[model samples]
Target chain A: MNLETPALIIEEGQVRRNIAKMAGIAAACGVALRPHAKTHKLPEIARLQIGAGSKGITTAKLAEAEIMAEQGIDDIFIAYPIVTEAKLERLATLSRRINVIAGVDSLEGATAMNETALRRGVPLQVRLEVDLGFGRTGVPYDHALELAAAIAKLEGLQFRGIYTFRGFFMNGAPTLELEAAGLEEGRLMVELAERMRAAGLEVRDVSVGSTPTAEYAARVPGVTEVRPGTYVYYDRMQAVLGSCTLDECAAAVRVTVVSRPEPGRLVVDGGSKTFATDVGPGAPPLHLIGYGHILEEPDAVLERVSEEHGMVRVPEASPLRVGDVLHIIPNHICSTVNLHSRVYLQDGGQMRELPVAARGAIT
Target chain B: MNLETPALIIEEGQVRRNIAKMAGIAAACGVALRPHAKTHKLPEIARLQIGAGSKGITTAKLAEAEIMAEQGIDDIFIAYPIVTEAKLERLATLSRRINVIAGVDSLEGATAMNETALRRGVPLQVRLEVDLGFGRTGVPYDHALELAAAIAKLEGLQFRGIYTFRGFFMNGAPTLELEAAGLEEGRLMVELAERMRAAGLEVRDVSVGSTPTAEYAARVPGVTEVRPGTYVYYDRMQAVLGSCTLDECAAAVRVTVVSRPEPGRLVVDGGSKTFATDVGPGAPPLHLIGYGHILEEPDAVLERVSEEHGMVRVPEASPLRVGDVLHIIPNHICSTVNLHSRVYLQDGGQMRELPVAARGAIT
Candidate 1:
C-alpha cells in the first residue's frame, strides 16, 4: 500500500541495528539499558528493543508506562517529575503492573509522592533529576544533593538513585569531549549516590543518559543504567552532534509536493503538523537549507513550514516536482514521530506496505 | 480524573451554546450547518452540533471524517484539496459510510477523482473550493467559472457546491464593514452558482464562511451553507476582532505552574504544544498585554512560551506561586484543541470529563 504523505516511516532493520548498538554500549560498561520509549511511542518498536536485551523502558509520563505495561512490558521508568494528583494516582495504579520509577526534583514533590504512595499502599520508586545543563527542568546541581537526601528520608518511597539528562552535552566541541563532560556528570551522580547510600538509603540504580551521552554513560563505572531515547530513531540534531550519521536515522516522514506556488518554492503536504515546530537551541534556520533535509534530495533541506504547507525552497537546478514523493529527516525525530498517529515498518529498502501496530501511544 | 495540566478544557455548556447560535444563524439563512469538525474532533461534540440542527459535519481530511464516522457521525464534507492515491482511497471508504464531499482545485485533481469514482464504482460528491481571499488553498476566484465548467463535465461526480473559508476576516476591517465584505464574497459565490446552473450543473451547495463571517453569511441571499468551526471555541483573535468577549470563549487550556526558577518568572506545564504557535497574519503580538493573559488575571497576558516552558514574567510583588493552576486562552482555539489527546469537558462552571475521540486526525 502507498502510505499517505505526512506519515512517519521507520525501517525495522535500521531500528534493530541501532538498538543493538545502544545495548552493546550499555553491556560493555555493565550498565542496564533503559531505552526511552518516548522517542518511539509505538510499543512494537519498544518490544523490538526490549527483545534485544534492554533492562526496561523509560517513559516521560505515568500514563505512557501504564499503556506499555498493559501491553505486557513490565519494567518501566518514568523520567519526569510527576506532582499533580491525577498523575500520582496513575503512577500508583501502574505499580501493580510493573517496576515503575518516577523522577523528582523537590522535597515537597517527594513528600507528596510519599504520601500518595502510602495512601495507595505501594512504594513509589523515584530517581531525583539533577540539572546538569539543560536548564528546562530539574533541580540545581547543588540542590540535587539536598533533594536526594530529602528523598532518602521520605517514607513509602524508594530512592533508587539519582539521574540527570545531559541534553546540554548535545553540542560542545567533539564527540570525545562531549563524552568526557558526560563522564564528569556521571561521576558527580556516583558521588551523590554514595552520599545517599551513606545516609542509609538503598541507592543501587544510578541512571543518566540521552542519545548524545549514550557512549559516555556506558563508560561511567558507577552508573548503574543509561536512559537514551532518541537513539532508537536518531534525528538531525544527533547527526550534527556526531552522535550518529544521517544514514543511521531510522525514522523519516514521507511527504508529497502539492504546490509550486512560486518559483524556488515547493509546497508539500507535510508542514509543522507532520515535521513539528521544534527548533532546538542553535538549530540552523529551517529555511536556511530546508525545514528538514529531503531524504530523496541528499543536498536539499525543507526551508520552512506553515500549518498545512511546507515551503521547500529548492535550487533552480533541483529536479524535484509537484506530486513527487520525498522522505524528510526531521530536526527532532521523537517530536515529529509523536505528531503522527501511526508509523509504517519497512524492510531495509522495501516499501512501507502495512501499518505496524502500537503506533499512537498518547498517554 | 484530575485533568492533565496544559490540557484543552472545553466548557460543554458554552460550546453547546455556541453551536446553537451558529445552527440558528444557518437555519435563519436557509443554509445547511455543516460545521467544520477540524476545530474539535470529538464525536460527542459533532453529534451535539448535528443534533442541534446542523445539516452535516465538515473535515479537513477523509481520515478525520472516518474517525468521526467510527463514533457514528455521517454526512461529512472534506473541505481541503486532496489528490494522493491513499487519500483518495480513504475518501472513497468514507463515502461508503457517509455522504463524503471532497474538495477539488485543478484539472489533475478532478481527473484523479473521476478515475477514483470510476474505479471504485462510487459517485464522489465534490465541493469546488473558491479562493475568495485566503491565498493558501482553493482555485483562484477568476478561474472558478472555468473549473466549475470543467468539474460539471466529469462523470460519476456530483458538483455539490462552492465554498470559501473566510478565515481571519476579523483582521480585514471593523465588524460591520467586514460583514459587508463577507456579503460581497457571498454574492460572488451566488453569481458563481448561477453561472454553474447556467451550464446545466446542479448548484444546490454554495458554502462560504468562518467564525468572523458567520453573522454576515446568515443573511446572504444565494448562500446555501455556512461552515464556521471556531465559534464553538472562540480564541483571542476572535475576542480581539469583536466576534466575542473573553468570557464567551468556550475553550481554555488549564495549565499548572511547573517551574519558578526566578522570582518574577513562572513556568507552566503548558507550552507551544497545548497553546499552539498558530499566530495568524496581522494578529496582535502574543501577550502584548505581555506572552499570554492569565485566566485568573483576566488582566495579565501569559507573555511567552518556549517548546516546553511558558515564561510568565510577572510582577515580583505578585503572589503567583509555583503550583497555582492557570487557565490560558489560546491565540487560536482550533490549533490548541488539535494539540491534545482528549479535551477535558465541563458542565456549566464545574469541569466534567469527556473524550476528544478525534484528537490526532492527521492522516
Candidate 2:
C-alpha cells in the first residue's frame, strides 16, 4: 500500500518476536505475563500476545479495558487507581463481563470501588499499588499492608494482591549496584506478601511491571505476574537504555520530507502531534538526543517538533529531497501510539492498517 | 453530569465571547476572518464561528476539510503543504464538494496539485506561503514570487495569493519593538502583493494568521483575510502572553486529584497524555512554569507529567484531597485539544459533550 505520510508503522515480525521473547522470559522465571495493552491499544496485538502465552492483558484505563472486553478479551487488569464514582461505576460494569482487576492505593479509593461493586452486584478484584521508588502513584511500601488489609476487609472487594511499577530505572541498563537494588526491591515486595499472608490475608497475585525491571522482578520468589507495556514496541528510549536493541523496536512513524528550507535543515510532515515530545530519560552512556531517531540518516536529529512540523537537522551535504519518506523511531512508543487513530503493520513487504482500538482512552 | 476525571472542559460563554472579539477585530480592520478550525476541530464550533460572522474556516489538514465539508462547511483553506499522491487524491475529492484552497511553497507541490486537479477535471485554488520569520515551513519571501508565477502558469491551478503565520511571536504579547517588527512584516507582505500585481498576476487574497499577530496583520493595507485559531480557546499560555485574560480562557482539562503522595505533592489523573508537556516559549515576565495552570489554585504548578500521572506541586498548606476535580488551562490549547476524542462544553453551568471531529487528522 502507498501509505500516507505521518503514519504509525509497526513491524509484524518484530512485534511477534518481542511478544515471544518476553513471554518466554516470564515462563522461564515461573511467572505469568500480562502484557500491557495501553502501548499498542489494539486488540489484535493483545490477541497475538495471548496466543504467544500471555495469561491476560493489562490496560491503563477503564475505557481501554472496556474496549478489550468488547473484543472478547475476558481477562483485563486496569493498572490505574480508580477513585471517582463515575469510573468506579464503569469498572463495576466492566467487572461483570470480564475478570477485571483494579488497582487502588488509598482507603477511600478502595471503599469507593467496594461501594460501586456492591451497587452493581459484582465483585471487584483489586491490587494495592505500592511505591517502589517510581513516586508517581502507589502507596509507600510501608503503607501498602494497611491499605491492603483494609481493602481485604471491605465488602464486595477481593484484595487479590499487590503491584508496583518501578519506572525510575527505565532509563538504562541497571548498573551492578542498581541491579542489586532492584533485586532488593523485589525481595521487599516478596516480604510484603509474606507479611500479608501471615496476617491471614490471601495475597495471590503479586504483580511487578515496568519494562526495564520485568525480567528481574519476574524471577522474584513471590512475584507471580509481570505487566510490561513497552516490550511489544520498544522505542528509541528503550534501546538507548539497553532495554532492547534498536533492531527489536517494532513501532516507527513514516513521515515525508515536506520542505527543505535551508542547506542543513528540513521539515517533515510528522511533528509533536504524531511523535509526542516525550524525551524519555536520557541514559548518558547512549547519548540519544532530540525527539526521535531517523532510520534513513542515523546522524540526523529531529531537533524540534511543533504541532505538525518536525525540524530535522542533517549534514549540510545530505542528499535529502522533498516528498522522500523517512521512518522515525519515537522516543516513547506508548505516547506516540496514542497520537494516531490507525497504525500500519509491515508484513512481507506489505502494509496493513490496524485501528488503534483504544487511542485517547485516557478517561 | 457525573463525569470522569481528566476530561476537557470548554466554557461556552467564554468561547462565544472569544469568537465575537476576534470577529470584531477583523471587521474593525476591514478584513475577512477565517478562524482556524484546527484549534477546536469540532463542526459545532466551526458553525458557531461562521454564525459569528467568519468568512469561512481554515483547516490544518485535508482530512479536517473533508470532515467540515461533510458537516456542510463549504469553504475551507488547508494551511499546510500536502505533497503525497494519496493526499492529493483526497484533496481533489474534497475540492469536488467544497471551495478548497491549498497552500504550496514549492513548484513541485504546485505541479502535483495541478496534475491532480487536471486528472480529476476540477480547478484547485492555491496560495503561496511566504516565510515572515516563523522558520517552520513556507518559502522565503524573496523566492515566493517566482513560485507564485509558476503556479499561476500551471494548468487547472489558480494562484489565489499568499499567506504567512508569524508563529515565533506567539510566546508573549509583542513588546513595543516586537509590535514594530510585526507591522514591518505586514508591510513586507503588502509589498509582496504589490510586486505580484505589478508582474501582471492577479492576487486577490493576501492572508495572515496567528492569534498574537492577527489584529496587526489584518490592518495591513493589502491583507484581505486573517486566520487565528487559538482565539477560540484562550489557554493559560495565551493568558500569560497577554493574548487573553485568565477568565477569558475557554478551554480547560478537568482532572481529579487521585493521590496525595505527600504533604506538598499531589497526583492527578491527567498527565502528559491529557495535559501535553508543551512548556511553550515561556515569557520571563509572566513566570509560567510546568505544563498547565490550575484554574482553582492559580499558583499551584503542574510540576511534572508522566504518561498517566500529573505530579502537582502546591503549597504544603494546600488542602487538596482525592476526588477533588480541578480545571487546568493548558499551555497550548491546540495541542491539548487534540489529545481528547470528545470535549465537554460547559453551557449555562451544564456540561455537554462534543466529539472532536478532526482530531488525529494530521495526514
Candidate 3:
C-alpha cells in the first residue's frame, strides 16, 4: 500500500463482525445497546452501530453529542456531569431538538440543569450516575437514592434511570474474572433501581457494562442497556482481558520502520503521538508487555515510545528491515483513535479515509 | 472567566517571557536558538519565536515543516528521519521553498531521500543523528563516523552536521544532575563532530539539547544550535527537572470541579483526554505524584484520570466547591497541547483563541 506511516487503519470486515456480535449478545440478553461513540468518534461508525440495532449513542462530553447531533444522530446520552452554564445552555438547546439525556450525580448539577431546562422550556431527561465501586465519578451507592429522589423532584427535569461504570471489578476489587465482576456490576445497578422504585421514584433504565463486561453484564436479568465502546475495535488490553480474540480486533496503526538502530532494536515512525500512552505496557489486571502488538511479527515487542518514535525490541535474528511496514494493535483503541484526525478504512481490497468528526471534542 | 471547562489556557505575558529567556540563554552561549515547534504547534507562536531572535524553528515531521513554511517561516529543520516515499515527496516539495534540513540516522532513509532529491534535482541538506545513549533513535556512537561518511557520499545529499537528543542523562545513567548531564550531552556531540571533521566531512552545525538540557548543552564550544521545545510553556515535569519554576509555567488547563464524590476526592471535568497520559504521574527522575498540579489548591493531587474525569485527592477541610474553576499545570505540555484543537490566550484582561495548526502532523 502506497500510504504514509503512522496511519490508523480499521478493517471493515472485523468492525462489522464485532458490531454484529455485540449487538447479538445484547439482543439475546434483552438489553438495548448504546455503543459509546467516543470509541471511534466517527459518524459513519455511529451510523453503522445504529443500523445494527443500537438504541442510541453515548458520548463523554456534550461537544461530542453536538457533533453527532449535527450528523443526524437523534438520541445521545452525554454520560458526564456537565456543570458549566455555557455547556448547560448548549445542552438545553440540544435537548430541544433531540432526545438528549444528561448525567447528574449531585443536586448542584441537577439544579443547574433544571434551571436551564426551565428557562429554555425544555424538560431535560437525566440519569443518576451511581458510584458502584469505581471511585472516579458518580454519587456514592449509599447516597444515590437520596440524590435520585432530589433530582426527580426538580421542576424541569425527568429522572429517567440510573447508570454506573465499573469496568472489571468483583466485590469492589479489580479482577480478571469477567463473568463474576460483570454480574456484580449488573446486580448492584439492578438492586439500586429496585430501591429507587420502592421509594416511589421512576427508574426506567438501568445501564451498565464496558467492552470487557458487556456480555456477562447484559446477561444479568435487570441490565436494561449496555454501553460498550471499545468492542467495535478491540485492542491489546481487551485481547488480554479475554473479551475478544486478537483476530477480532479491527483497528491497527500502520507504521514504517524508520531506523534499525541496533541488532535487537528497531524504531518505527509512530510513538505516543500516534499510539497514545493512556494504556501503559505493564498496567495492572492486564500486564500487557508492550505499547502495542505487531501483527506481522508477534515476537517483536513495542517496548518504549517517545513523542514521535516507537522503539521496538526484536530477536537478533529477525529479518525486519529499516523500511519494513508493520501493523500494530494499540493497547487501547479509544485513546489512540482520539489522537488522529482521520483514519483509513480497509474494505476487502479497497481503502478510503474517514474524518474523525469529533476528534477534539473535549469541551 | 465565562469559559468552557477543560480549556487550554496560555498566559501571553509568560509566553513572551519564556521565549525571551530561552533566546537569551542561547545567545549568551554563542549558539543559535532553533526552538522546537512541536510543543506549541502554532504558527503564530513560531512567528513570535522568530521575532524574538530564533534562528529558525524545528518540527518533528515534514508535514509540520510544510505548515510552518506555508505560514511564512522560511527556515525549518525536520528533526525526525523522513523515510517513506510519500513523505519524501512532501519533503522535496517543502525543501524547494525554504531552508529545510532533514535528519538521517541510517543509509536506507538517506538513500530514499537521495533518490527523491536526485529525481527532483534538489540537494537535500541532511544531519546525522548520533545515538549518545538515549537508546531511542539515532545511529550508535561507535558507528557515527561511518554513517556520516556514507551519507556524505550520497549524490543528492549534503551532510551538514550531527545532532542527538539525550535528555537528563549522566554517563549513560538517568539522573537528576542537570548540569553534568547537559554538559556531557553537549561534549559527546562536539567530540563526534570533531571526529567527523577529521574524517574530512564538513560538520558545520553540531546541534543538540532538549528543554532540560539546552542551557548547559549550548555552552559547549562546538555546539552551534539548541532545540528546546517545552521551554516555551514550562510544564510540571520541566519544573520538577529544575528547568523552570512553577510560576514560569505559562500554559495550564482550566477545569471546573464537577463532582465531590467523597470527602477527600473531587472529580474535575478533565482527564486523560484533556491532560494527556504521555508523561505519567510517577515517571522517573521527576517522580511527579499527580497528573497535574492545581494552582489554587497546592496540596491537592490530581490522582487518577478516566477518559473524561480527573479524580483529585484533596484535603478533607478544603473549601473547593462544584462549579469552581481551577487551573492545572500539566506534566507534559507538548502532549497536552496536541490533545486540543484551539487554546485560549490570556493577555491581561483580553482573551482570544489560537489554533494548534500542526497538531496531528505525525507522518
Candidate 4:
C-alpha cells in the first residue's frame, strides 16, 4: 500500500486475534471483559470488542465516553473522577440516555456529582477508585472503605462496588515479575471488596487490570471485570514485558527515511509528534532501547526525536536509504494512537481509514 | 473562567506582546522575522505574527504550509525535507499558488522534488538545511557546499539559501550559556553562507535560530531571517532558557485538581495527553523539575503522570484542595498545542475559542 509516511497503520488480522485471545482469557477465568476504549479511541473498535464478548467499555475521560455513546456504544464506564461542574453536567446528561458509570475517589468529587445527579433527576452509578499504589489518582487504599460509605450515603448516586489500576509495580518501580505484581493487585482488590461486602456495603463489579496484568488478575475469583486497554493493539512495551509477541502488535507507524545525513544516523519523517514521548527509551523494567522497534531493520533504534524529525541509529553497513519506507512499532500504542486523527486499517487485502472519533477527548 | 479542566489557554495580551517583542528584535537587527507556525498551528496566530511585521511564516511540514496558505497567510517556508512523492506533489501544488520554499538536505530529496516541480511546471524555491551539530536533520556541514551546488544545478529548483536548527548546544550538551551558544550558531551559519556565495552560488536567505537563540543569531551579519517558533507563546522551556520570563508565557493548560489522594499528593485531570511528555523533568541545562509549572501553587511539582492523571507533589502545609483550578505552563508549548484541537484565547475580559487548524498536520 502506497500511503503517506508517518501514517498510523492498524493490522486487522492481529487486532482480531488479540481481541479474541483476551476475550477467551476472560471467558476461561469466568470474568467480564470491559476493554478500555482509551487504547483505540474509535467507536468501530469498541463495537468489535463488544461483539467479541466484551461486557462493556471503559474510558479514561468523560468526553471519550460521550463520543462512544454518540456513535451508538451503549454501556461505557468512565473510570476517571469527574470533578469539574461542566464535566459533571455532561456526565449526568449522558447517564440520562445510556448506562454510564462514573468513577469517584474523593468526597468532594462525589458530592459534586451527587448534586448534578439530583438536579438532573437521574441517579448516577459510581464506583469508588481505590488507589492501588499507582500514586496517580484514585482514593487511598486505607480510606477506600470510608469514602465508599460516604458515596453510598449520597441519595442520587449508587455505590456500585470498587475499581483500581495498578500496572506492574513492585517496590515503587516498574517490575518485570508481572505474575507476582498481577496476583498481588488482584488479591488486594479482592480482599478489599470482601471487606466492603462484609461491612454490608454492596460491592458488585470489582474492576481491575491493565494490559500487562489483565489475565493474571482475571485468575482471581472476585475480579468481576478486567479492563485491558492496550491488549487490542499490543505495543513494543507489551512485547518486552512478555504480554504479547512483536508480531501480535497490531499498530505500526509507516515512516519514510527523509535524510541520511551521516553514516550511522538516518532521519525519518516521524518524530515525537508521530510516536508520542510518553514512554521514553530510558523507561525502567524493560528498558527497551528505542522510541520504537523498526520492523524491517531490527537493529535500528529510533534514538532521538524532535517535533518532526526522528533520528534513527542504524548499523553503518545497513542498506537503509533516503526515501525508503520503514514500519515502526511504537513503545506505547495508546498514546501513539491518541496523537493521530485517523488510522489506516489493513484488513486482509483491503485497506480503509478509521477516524479516531475520540482523538482529543481529554476533557 | 468556568471552562472545563485540561483546557489549553492562550493569554492574548501576552501573545500580542510576545509577537511585538520578537518582531521588534528582528526589526532592530535588520533581519526578516518569519515566526515558525509549527508552534501555534493556528492561522489566526500566524496572521497576528504577519501583522506584527513578520515577513512570512515557517512550517515544519508541507501540510502545515498548505493550511497556512489556504488560510491566506501566504509566503511559506517548509523547513523540513520533503522525500515522499505525495508530499512533493502537495508542495509543488502549494508553490504554484504562493511563494513556497522547500527544504533540501540530500541530493535524492532534491531530485524527487525537482521531478515534481518539473512535472508541475513550477520552480520550487529550496533551502539547504545544514547540520549545525543538532544531529537530527539537515545535511552535514562539510558536504553542504557540494549539495548546495548540486541543488542549484537542478533546473526546476531555486537554491534560495541555507538554514539550520541548533537550539542550545555547547560542546555536545545543552548549555546555560545562551549567548555563547547562540553566537556560535549564528557565526557558523554565516560563515557557511559566505563560503557558498564565494563559490558563485546565489545564497540569499540564511535562516536560523529557535526561540531561545533567535535574537542572538539574528545579530550575526549575514543571517537574513530568524525562525523562532515558540516565542509567540513562550513555554516553560523558553522561560527556563532565559528567552522570556515565566509571566511572558502566554499558553497554559487549565486543569482542575480531581483527587487529593494523599496528604502531600494532589492529582490533576490533565496528564501526558494534556501536557505532552516531549520535554521531561530531567531535560538538560535546566533539569526542569516537573511536567508543568503551576501558576497558583508555584511550589507544587507535577511529579508523575498516567494517561489521564497528573500526580502533583505539594508542600504538607499547602492549602490546595480537590476541585481547585490550576493553570500550568507546559515545558514545551509546541507539542502541547498539537495535542489540543482548540484553545481559549483570554484577551482582557473577553474569552473565545480558537481552533488549532493545523494541529495534527504532521505528514
Give the alpha-carbon lDDT of every model: 0.74, 0.85, 0.91, 0.91
List candidate 2 stretches off by more than 4 Å: A119-121, A169-181, A280-287, B169-178, B280-287
| Model 1 chain A lDDT-worst window of ten | A280-289
Candidate 3 regions exceeding 4 Å error are A169-172, B170-172
DockQ values per model: 0.26, 0.66, 0.82, 0.82
For every model in order, the fraction of real contacts preserved is: 0.14, 0.61, 0.79, 0.87
lDDT of 3 by residue, B49-117 (tens): 999999999999888888888899999998888888888888888888999998999999999999999
lDDT of 4 by residue, B79-102 (tens): 999988888888878877898898
Error of 1 at B131 (Å): 3.4
TM-scores of all candidate predictions against the true structure: 0.85, 0.95, 0.98, 0.99
What value of lDDT does candidate 4 attain over all alpha carbons?
0.91
lDDT tens readout by residue for model 4, A85-122 = 88888998899889989999999999999999899998
lDDT of 3: 0.91
Model 2, residue pairs in steric clash:
none
User: A216, model 1: CA deviation in Å?
Assistant: 3.8
Top candidate by DockQ: 4
Off by over 4 Å in 4: none
TM-score (0 to 1) for chain A, all models? 0.91, 0.95, 0.98, 0.98
List the RMSD of every prediction in angstroms: 4.5, 2.7, 1.2, 1.2
